[model samples]
Target: MTRVVLALDSFKGSITASAAAEAVRDGWLSQRAGDDVVLRPMADGGEGTLDAFAAAIAGARRRPVTVTGPDDAATDAAWLLLPDGTGVVELSSTSGIEVLGGQLRPWDAGTVGFGEAIAAALAGGAQRLVLGIGSSASTDGGVGALTALGARFADADGAPVAPGLRGVASAASVDLAGLRALPPGGALVLSDVSNPLCGPRGAAAVFGPQKGLDAAGVVAADAALARLAALVADAAGPAHPGPATPGAGAAGGTGFALLAWGAALVPGSAEVAELIGLDAAVAGADLVITGEGSYDDQSAAGKVPAFVAQAAAAAGVATALVAGRIAADADVSAFTAARSLTDLAGSAEASLADPARWLRAAGTALSRTV
Candidate 1:
């Protein structure tokens, strides 16, 4: 009987993280009866972040508030209040691209609502803040968020501009006087990306297309971000280490904003794992399995599975991965082995429509070797 820990991210468009974990458990149990298993669903500060954190802290309160969406629409979003008084804010709940429906434009999205949510959590007496910066639809470099928090981004005319990366280019001044001072302990922003806010390989070039930006849009967005960066440097003195670090381009440069506002940039998966006590869970496990929807060259660039694999490796535990699909001949050195659910299920549509069946099958196959 092997003690196994199943930690998987959401399959995206197919299954939730919890369902994916359960599928693995059921599949593994079918092969090895009474095997010790622990299920820990995971996220990279993106779509499933709130759910994963809520599940980790069972029965937590999800407080809803109105925030600006990707299309500048008033939309509902939530923040979690745990029993321990730590407030968890997932930006996607407010400014996610998925909430846009058919209207997807990075130039128009904003992070103002995210700042409002933070303020709401503070008013509710939250002592610590854990902000997850992923799955955003804005490229304002967090200018909109700051505006929501009382920091103003004004044009040369001294009038406020609409939120999004487009506003960044015209930004000539920033006012931070109105921001509510953080409590004595301050806040911690948990970002999943390391890309800088500006430059060729920065936010716009890497993430603009994902938000429906064309080549021209990318170029414009990049220029806008460069202008915003210059403004930040003028205001804050210099670009911080974590903001300019790799993976900081996440959530359309929200990571840069966090750094500017004095948030620490720990590894997103590592921070989540620490919060959920994954090290303790791994110590008692014989094998650990983790994965996401896709595995490719980018997985090495701070994706969830790679983080889990690193943690498992640190614990001297063997790890395996099961994704919906694996990039052809991708580097799997991060895990002991890797497999694709699509390979066993025969087709992507079949696998997505009936993920439970395929996940179980894939788990069973991996269990034989583990």
Candidate 2:
């Protein structure tokens, strides 16, 4: 009997990692009842990051808080507190584009909700913070989040600025005087993107289009991010984070703003994997399965699948993937075998409408082969 590990990333917009792992385990059991199976839910600093932490940490509890959302509406958000005094907060839960549904507002969306949740965690005696800044809807240069922590963003008239490009463009000064101090263990900002805060490869230019910004809006957002960076550095003095730092452009400059608060940017997959004990699980497994919604070239770039494959490889174990859609040009050579639910279901729409059905089929196929 094979000792298999189900370490799958959440199929965004469909099944989560926890659900996918269950289906995979069930299907594998159907094929080989005696096979040993280990479930390890995975994420790459995106939507399901908090779930991953909750699965890994003992005594992790959800702390609920109400705050203003990206759409400028009151909403409820939850931050996680680990047994070791670590706070887990995902920006997507509070200020993500999904919160607004199909109505995308790049210029006006902000991350104040995320900050409020973090502040709540701090108030509860969190000694450290693990912030997941992916899938955020805002490009406010993180002024909104910083503002919630008591950093002030003012215009030329000394009046407080609005969120997003409006605030960054008309900003003349900033004040970090009343901002909350970092926890004893500081902060770890998770992001896989290496883009700088402002430039051609920056947040607005590269990611703004997806956030519903036009060319002019992208240009404006970039300049605004630059202005925010300069103003922050001027006020913060020597601890200023350089603009060229990797991941400064993440979540619309939220990564850069976190740096201003003296946080370190780390690779999301590696950090999460360490927390979830991926290496230990893979060590004794005969095979490991990992996947995502789309297993493409981007997945190879430090996403959960590639990271899991690397860890399994180091342990002399084989890794396989079961993805929602597999691009023809995707380099999935790292996997011992790759299966696509879309390919099995005959169409993307059909596969997405019911991902678990095909995901189970893929697991059975892998169980027989692996």
Candidate 3:
């Protein structure tokens, strides 16, 4: 009997991470009658992050807090904490694009409440802070987050600006006197994006459209980010690598803000992998399988499958990817092999109609080759 580790991301609108993992297991079991399999579902700090983390940590409490949503509307979001004083905050929980009810305008969104969430975690005496920077609907260059944490952003006239992306562009100066109030330790920001804070390939241009911003809006948002960057540089002395780094453009510029706040930037998949002991599991397994909802050129940009493939390759383990749909340009050759559930089901509609059945069937088919 062969031992296998099944780690996969959620199939987006079709299946949850756990379900996908189960489907993979079912496939393996069907083909290999006496196989030992371990299922570890993963999320990239986006829509399913809360569910994924909840699954990962046993006995973690889900606590709700009120934060500003994408539309400047008051909404309640939740975070997780363990008895050991480890706290987790997902940026999307407060300012995610999904929470906006389909009206995703980055200019109007704010990270203010995200900062408040951090404050709450600090007040609760959390020893470790894991900040997930994914699925944000804001493009305020983190001004809102900074403001919530006690930093003051003032215009040239010295009056405080409203907290949002609009205000970030007008920021002429910043006051960081509030840093004294932060918890007495470091923070880790888990981000899955690799875009910088400014320029053509920056956050605004790369992600603004997804948040309902037009080309003009993207340009404005970019300018706002540039201005905010200047303000941050004035206060923090210098910009950090993670904010200006390639992967920093994720989550509507939230990555830039986290970097400015001294949060350590770790690959989101890699962080989750470490928590679930994925490397160890892969090493002990005869085969490894991982995937996401969509496998495209962007998947190479720090997505779950890419990270898993990298790990498996380093460990000399054979790996396969199973996605709901595989992009035409995706480098499938990068993995030991890759396939889509859609291929076996004939069409997307058919596969989605009964995802579990298709997933299991697809997994079984792949198991024979392994």
Best by lDDT: 2
- Colliding residue pairs in candidate 2: none
Query: Model 1 off-target regions past 4 Å?
Result: 238-243
Shift of residue 3 alpha carbon in model 3, Å: 2.2
Q: Write the per-residue lDDT of candidate 2 for residues 262-330, one digit (tens) a residue.
A: 889998988888888889999999999999888875566557888899999999999999999998889
lDDT of 3 at 273: 86
Q: What are the per-residue Cα lDDT tens digits for candidate 1 across 1-370? A: 7899998888865788889999988998998888998988888877788898887777699988887777777888889998878888888778776777647876778888888888889888888888888778878888888777777789999989767876887888876657667655667776666677767768888878878889998898888777776676567565455446665577888887766676666667877787688888988888999988877766766778888888888889999999999988678977777879888888887887898899899889988876
Q: Rank order by lDDT, top first?
A: 2, 1, 3
Candidate 3: residue 345 lDDT (0-100)? 91
Scored against the true structure, residue 350 in model 3 reaches a CA lDDT of: 88
| Cα displacement (Å) at residue 345, model 3 | 4.9
CA error at residue 125 for candidate 3, angstroms: 2.4
Best by TM-score: 2
Least accurate 10 contiguous residues by lDDT in model 2: 294-303
Candidate 1: minimum summed lDDT over ten consecutive residues — where?
238-247
TM-score of each: 0.91, 0.92, 0.89
Of 2 and 3, the candidate ahead on TM-score is 2
